[model samples]
Every structure is written in structure tokens, then in C-alpha cells.
Target: MSEPAVTQHPYYHPQPGTAWEHVDTAGSLLAGPTPLVTLANWQEEPHHVWSFQHMRELMPSQVIDGTDEPRPLPEAPSDLSALEVPVAWAPTVEELLDRTQTDAFLVLHRGAIIDERYVGRMGRRRRHLVMSVTKSIVACVAASLAGDRLLDPDAPVEAYVPELARCGYAGARVRTVLDMRSGVTFRETYLDPDSEVRVMERSMGWAPRNHGDPLGMYPYILTTTAGRPHDGVFDYRSIETDALGWIVERAAGRRMSELISERVWKPIGAFHDAEITADPLGVAIHDGGLSATLRDLGRFGLMLHDHGDVAGRQVLPHWWISDAAAPPVDVREAFAASVNEPVLPGGWYRNQFWFVPGDNGPILLCLGIHGQMVFVEWSTGLVGVKLSTWPLPQDGDKLVATINAFRAIGRTLAREGG
Candidate 1:
């Protein structure tokens, strides 16, 4: 008989000094009594009890292996050892490692899983939350819809979701939302009690405890208001993704979960079922609720690496891939200027993906808060996935170093192959 799985003592808690908080609302809703999950309890081998293969029921994802089985990965160099990257920012990667505390890491290049490691309680199958990486998934859904002609990137948000007409989405175009140029006044401070993110937590059942509050996710989204005009400055707001989800649902005549399954998940041959949390009303939380295993995340990255085509089928229009990967005209300079960090310079965001404009080659990435990334370098056929439960509000220095390391590795492999 198998022994029951147990949780190890967490070394990283969302709130450092708080007690072990637990929320109860049927299950683990985001709001309510349980404090936001932190990475504290992670320990060593005693924690190997948790893995991704056993946690499939907790989230949404579709597993894809072989023409149905696991495909052979490309051969990798014998030793990666540990590469050190100098820090020229506020915090070094080592410093952030001490502060936020990271749990696991995996990197793949040219179809091969090159580097993989675990720390504390993290293991091969443990499903950690992807946070805002969900936004990029939603973006992919939107792009797929555009490819099918069900959506027009230039169309107004009102074209699909009429309810957003009076909200901050009033005059926003689909393109603006994709670029996060929607002038929404969403307060994103994770620690602020009155921030919109907190309110969202309450709405999604993620807040610590808030009884007598509306129980579903959609109502919270419906109530969001517009703060500024569309297409101005770059503001990262989860609400825009929520609005985009609504648009996708309205146009497709199905739930976002089902749409993703049919359009992306199933087609890509994912290795597990990815789950998206919902409000009591059952509307999918498109902003940041999706979760999946690291390997499956790599598969999704591979799908993009193949140019939105899998098995020779043009799953997504080539033009859609081209556009989403293209650098946005308006924000290129601003984004480039913002990349003052040593490792990443001249980075930009387009179609909910991050773009490294002037690196070894053009790089596009799907990044989530707290160290979740699906980085793709098309020029070299490289795709890397890193999933972590690092203490939130990210350590920019560590992220830059890791990205630089991946880029460096990709260049080395490409040159060797040549």
C-alpha cells in the first residue's frame, strides 16, 4: 500500500510572519481565510512526496505524449554545472535566492530538456500556480480566435462583450488590450489591502476571508470600471485579461476552459489537464488562475517554437504568430528604455508576450510573476520553461540572470551544431 502524501514545513510563506493560514470555502478558494500561498514549507527529499503526475486533478491541462507517447528529446551537453551571471541591478540572483526563495527550475533547448533541478519541496510533478502566466495563455486563446476570423484585433472590445461598453473597456480595441494599453485603473499592488488585485482575490475566492461577499468570479469582473482612456501608457492589469476572456467566450459561444482545450491544449498534445479556477458562478478566471505542470508548459512553448503549427497542421495562422511576435511600434522605445537591467536591454511586450528586441536574436517569452516563464528563441529552435514558487513581487535581478543564462546556452548550442 502507498503512504499518504504529506506537506513539508514551508520555509517561504506569502506573509513572512503570519501563522499557517488556511481558507475554507468548500475547497481552496483564493479569497476567504487561507492567506495567499507562499513557498515557505518547501524542504528537501522528505518532500519528494509531491510531484506533477499525481496533482493533475487540482488544475486544468491536457497531457500530450508520443504521436501519443513522450517524444525523444535532443541530446544535451554532459555538464551544465552552474553558471554564474554578474548582477548590475538592485538585487543579485543569489541575493534574490536568499530573499524570495525558489523551488524548481527546468530548461529546454531545440526540443531537448537540457537542464532540470529541484529544491526544497519542489519535485517533477508538483503543480505550482502560474500566476500571471495565465494572462499569456489567454492571449494565445485570443490569437487563435483571431486566426479563425472570429476576432479582429483592431475591433473594439464592445464588438464581442457588450457589457464592457460602459466599463474601462468602453473604447478599448482588442489590440490595445493585448498590449496592456487599456487605460484601466486597476491597482496591482499585491500587499495593498484596498488594491484591485485584493478585490480580485476576494472575487476569485483567493482572499484570506470575506464572507457575505459575492461568491463568483464574473460579477467581480463585471463591476470593474474604467480609469483612463485606452492606448496610452503601459499598465499591467489583470482585468484586461478578464475582459478578453469575456470577449472570447461571447464570440466562441463556449467557456474559456473548453475553448482553450480545443484550440490549444488538445491540438498541442499536452501531457496533462490544465485547470482554471472559477468564481462561484463558474466563469473561468482568465487573468491568472490557470495551472499546469512544467513539462506540459514546455510542450506549449514547443508549440510556439514550431510557429503555431503542430504535426504539419496550421493550427494557428502564420500571420497571427508573426504579428504577436512582432515588436509593437508605439511602446518599443519605452520598453527598450525600461530594460536598464544588465542582462536584459531593450525588452518589449506584444500580444501579452515579452520580446527581447536586440539580443543574440529576437526572443519572445511568456512570463508570469514569481518566476514562471516559457521562453522561445525561434532563430535557434530553442524553448525553455521555468516554473517556480518564488516569493512574490519578483526579484528582477534573478530573472535577468536566468534569462541571460538561457540565451547564452542557446547561442552555444547553435554554434556547436553549426
Candidate 2:
């Protein structure tokens, strides 16, 4: 199966070296010798390159432990550097990775690794922050619990977390929150100091809190108010996922990290224990905060591509994967009316996964701020994970280019009988 052909875009020069390769000579580009990374500056420029891979050092975190016997991702090592992507700025796979500040890149086709690269300060053992990609991973828990009748998707958010009865989540169903269609009025503006996202950061202890601000994630969420009616157009709010985390915890009578460990990490036979940043009050930050190694994330993407299969053991619910892969027809209409439609035409958001129209079918995208992506092309049996620190929260061009690069690679490998 061939992918849609791409016109060669004008080539652009990539930076000289990996993100951390350039040292100022005065000292380290970020901090001298041993960089002084703190919660306040960890997400900032130069500091982020190091802090993203070392988040546990700056904050309280809970581990999602992997299994003693890990799943083998045998290597086939194909040269994919010359593969041309569709975007104008970075024409080839190598340049696209460098230009976009990729920390780690891996491609798995039919469950075997075809290509893998680790940039400066990145290694097989180093865990990198995946930002909003964490939402999709955490959602697995909600779906699994629901499959077991431990959770009720049609139930209102307040039913699980009664404390939210007076908040913006009032009357919002669990299904609505999973799809990010809740009427929550929180703004997602990352750079705005006064935006709800940044304020939520303070609550999660990822940023310095202002005086009189909510002390924890739950407290802050309790203050939000509804901006519109429930089941409206997709809003892409991170807090909705956080609320889902809370709901799952309340439903299963377990912590989010524990749930992920039991339901995902171990079943997938991940190589290392993944961790999520915790608030001062010890609640896992489900909106983001997950830092995991590259290969472990690849294993996760592979599991999705295989439709919940983990070495022949069914780990995720079949119904959940089916629903996410081919969502209801109305999902596309909901996404079309959203601001994201311009970037992802003919795409939809369901079961916490993003789907974009593809040559063969819809491509499942688990995206996060700052270039984190896990692209699963089920038709071609391809799964690719790219972890990056783009120095900005979002870049539409980089995001699109990365997707194209992965698609091109998948098409090539499929034709080659990979």
C-alpha cells in the first residue's frame, strides 16, 4: 500500500548539532557543570533540555513500574535519514529531527524496531517528559475500568468525584470528558501567565504558586466554572483529562500511577518504570507530567497498533481500541468545528486519542505540547514515537512535518515487506 505522494518542499538548513551539543564555552548552555534545574525554570528554554529528562529530580513523582521480564523489540536497523517529509522547512527525516529538537526517535513496524536514534543527553535509560501525550496513556485506565464494569462512562463527573458537583464539570458525563468536550471554561493558553493551564501548573507543583492560589490540583479544579453547555464542540482542555484521572481513581479505589502500572506498564512488558509528577498533596498530575523512556513509549504505541494485544494477552479492552480507531461519525464533525480542524482536517478526538485522515485510513496520534508524538498507523502495522523539546509549547509546522515523515517511513517499510 503506497502513501499519498508528497511534493518536495524547498529545503532548509538544520542547526549544527543536537540540542545539548552546543556548549556556550562559558559553561553548559543550560547550567554550569551540574545544571541547577528547578521547578520554576525546568520548563524554560535551555533548562528544559535537561529538566525534561530529569523531572523526578525537581519534583515529587510516583513510579509506574515495569516488569522484570521485558518485551523484546528486536532491531532491523534500516537507514531512514534520507526519507523526504512533506513540509517545506525540513525536507528529510534527519533534518526534520534536528530542526525540531528531537530528543529521541524510534520507528517500529509489525512489532520490530526498524530505526532508533538518541540525541544528546538521551539514552535508552533516560526518561523524557511527554507532556499532554500522558493523557492518552492515562485514558487507558479509564477505559479498562469501564470495560470491567468498575466505571460508568455515562455517569456524570460529579457522581465519581462528588466534590466537583458545584464546579464546571457538573453534569458532564465521563464520556464527554474523555473526548475533551466538557463545558469547562479553563483557557489552555500555555504562555499566558494568567491562563488556566499555567495556573494549574502551580497547583501541580510544576511551577511556583502565587499567594492565595489553589494549593493542589483538586482545589484548583473545584474553582472552575462552565463556559458553555456540555457535549459541545471539542475544547481540548487538559483539565478534563485530569478530572478523568480523578474519576478513575475514585471508581477503582486506586491511585492513577498504580492503575497504569497494573493495567499498562506491566502488561506491555515495558523495560523501565515510568513516572508521573505528583502534586504537593501527592495526587498524580494526569493532564501531563509523565516522563518515560523512548523504547517504553514505543512498546506502548506497538500495543495500541496491535489492538490491545500484549504478547497474545489482551491488556486493553478490544471495544476501547475499536472505538478510538474508528470513532462515531459525529466525532469528525465535532473536530471539524474545532480550532484543531485547521491543523488536522478530517480528524477527530475520541477515547483521548487524536485521529487524522490518512492515505490508507485514519492515523492515530497521541500528541503533546512541544513535539511529543506517538503515531500509530494500524493498517500498515507501524508505530512511531518522537520525543522532543521544541523550545515552544506547540509548532503546527513541526507537528505536521513529523507526521508526514512517519507516514512516509511507514509506506516505505510496508512496500519493502517489513
Candidate 3:
């Protein structure tokens, strides 16, 4: 097999004289008087430098409000600029930011902020796209419901969303959907504009669409059909999360925006409100499309690190968080034999969260396209978040390096008493 990406050359940037050289990320101006951000493709190139953080401006969305009395994170910001993280073949932490196109990143140890920084016009107040990290956040809410017997993991999807009675998800259990073993025809290809991902994006108003197209999240979801049998094998399906989101809403008799605000953001003490992109029909895109400030994202990670507790309150159920952190045994084996196998050696997906098994306790992760990550290392009580706008949608090398960087940071924190 070819060398693992984490063990490859460190610098993955384009050549010195390429057109992307010295591109302006502030106004997203590519050339003189020519802004790259257009309705046709605001998510493309230099445009995303702005769009990634200002998604609420480009699309219809609903606010997931935060609390007025936002609980404060203890700050002891250490200058990690010189902290030499020992990734297999990665650059220094400071250099990695530039090499990876990170917009903002934070490192927390034991619920206190140790290091945080911003680049490319990103700051503490602005909410940046956490992309599919939204899936994990929504998953936590779903698990909360399950903890309270409001939803049953073994219950069929049809039990929660009876409208799906005729769909592929009809007989699929909520547990199967959570584990991504619900065999579906959906394929997420970000490079192909004609792909299903783009179809969903257009339906959600991320890209331009025909004036009278079938324009709703539900319509797009109902169109999907199963391709193969689900035999306890893991498949990374983005639409599965959307289906689970529907189930959660039906079970709670509330919209995702309301439930997430009441259960997650408000109780967790997020500093600012988060937003989710919604279809023109006002249905929130629960699979992806969450945007929040970096620090707030870190706060969620810290909570997960503590197994869903903050201060003395059980913001999320400890048992539920523990269950998510440790998936079914068969599912874990299936995950190791699947796509995410390469991402994390022995990783499993449960309720949209990633559980990476190791000698240390599981590393709970929330990963997103274009390099958004919330890594909660329970073994060391460390948490980290990195939000980026990579030029390409998928880069295996960058992802491997990111995992390594987090590991290095975790090791340093554990050893030096962060």
C-alpha cells in the first residue's frame, strides 16, 4: 500500500507561483473589481473564505439561541505558537494552520482554554460553518431524547416519522441509523456539482436553483431509495442524519432549532447563538449546516470530555454520552472494515459521533467537511477544535495530519499537565 498521508511530506500547499498565491480573503476579491462570490457558487474558492463564516448572509436560516447568562470558560491562554507538536511528518502547529487553511482553532485542557487563535479575518464573535459537525450536535440531542424514553433506539424509524412508512427507512431501527448501517443510495461527492450533495445544497438555498423547483428538505429526503441490504456493515451516509433529525423532531414535537437551543446551546452556556441553514420551506438542514463561534464549539467538546456534564448540572445525560462513546461491538468491527477505517484505525460511529478506540479512553470526535473538527479526548480531559476552509472539499492527507496534530496535542497536554 502507498504510504499513509500522515507519514508523507509536511507541506501540501500549491506551488509558489500558482494563481492562488496571495489571494485576498477579506472581501473575497479575486481580481481587480471582480468579487468571486456569486449566486452561482458562493461556496467556491476565495469566496468561501467569507461564505464559510458568513453563511447566514447567503442562505435562509433559523437561530439556535444561546443563554443570556452564558457560563464563562476559565482562560489561561498559553502561547502555543512555539509548541512543537510531534506529528509523524507534519509541520509545526503554527505552520500547520497556514498549511491546512485553518480559519480559527482552539485547544482546551481540563475545561480551561489553553490556546486559541484566528486567521483570515475570523474572530471570536463571528460564527463559522461547522459543516457536518452539526450531525454530531444533533445526535447528542437525539440521544438525550432516548435517555428520557422519549425515543427508543431499537424502535423502527417509522415509529417516529410515520411519513417514512413507505420509505427505505421504514423498517430501519433508530440504532441502525445512528450507527450508519441503514443502507441507502445516497453518495456524498462534493467535487461533482451534479451529485446528490449539490442537490441538497440547492434545495437548502446554498447554491442557486430553478425558480419553481421541488424546493424542500423533506422532498429531497423522500426521493432517496435503498441500494443494498444493510447487514450490520457501516456506511457513511449524510442523509441518515437528516432522517434521524426528522425522527427526533417528531418524537419531541418540536423543531430542531428549538430543541437544540433549549437542550444544547442554552444549557451548555454557549457565548453566542448558533444558526442552521434551512430550506425555503423552513426545515433546518440537520445533517450539516451548523454555524457557531469557535469557542462555543470548544465548550461543547469540553462538555463531552466530562461525559455531558457542566458544573453541577447534567446538560446531557452521562449514560447516553458514554453509550455514544462506546458503540456496539459488531458495529465497531464493521466500522473498522469500512471507509472511516482509514480515518481512525478502529473508529465507530454512534449517534453521529465518532469513537476512536485506543489504550487511552475513546477519543470522541465531531468531524466535518472542509476540516471542521471537535476532538474530545476523555482519557486526558483535553478538547480541541479546528475550523478551516480548505481549497478542496476532500484531502486525505490533510485529514490524517489533523488527526495526528490532535494526538500530539493530547499527548503534550497529558504529559505536561495542561
lDDT of 3 by residue, 83-178 (tens): 576554556788777789999999998888999999968999999998889998898888778768899988888888878867666668888888
Evaluate residue 162 in candidate 3 and report its C-alpha lDDT on the 0 to 100 scale.
78
lDDT for model 2 comes to: 0.86
Clashes of each: 47, 0, 0
Can you tell me which runs of candidate 3 are displaced by over 4 Å? Answer: 1-33, 210-213
How high is each candidate's TM-score? 0.79, 0.91, 0.89
- Best prediction by TM-score: 2
Greater-lDDT candidate between 1 and 3: 3
Top-scoring candidate (lDDT): 2
Model 1 poorest 10 in a row by lDDT: 35-44
Each model's lDDT comes to 0.65, 0.86, 0.79
Minimal lDDT window, size 10, model 2: 6-15
Q: Tell me which of candidates 1 and 2 scores higher on TM-score.
A: 2
Model 1 reaches what TM-score against the true structure? 0.79
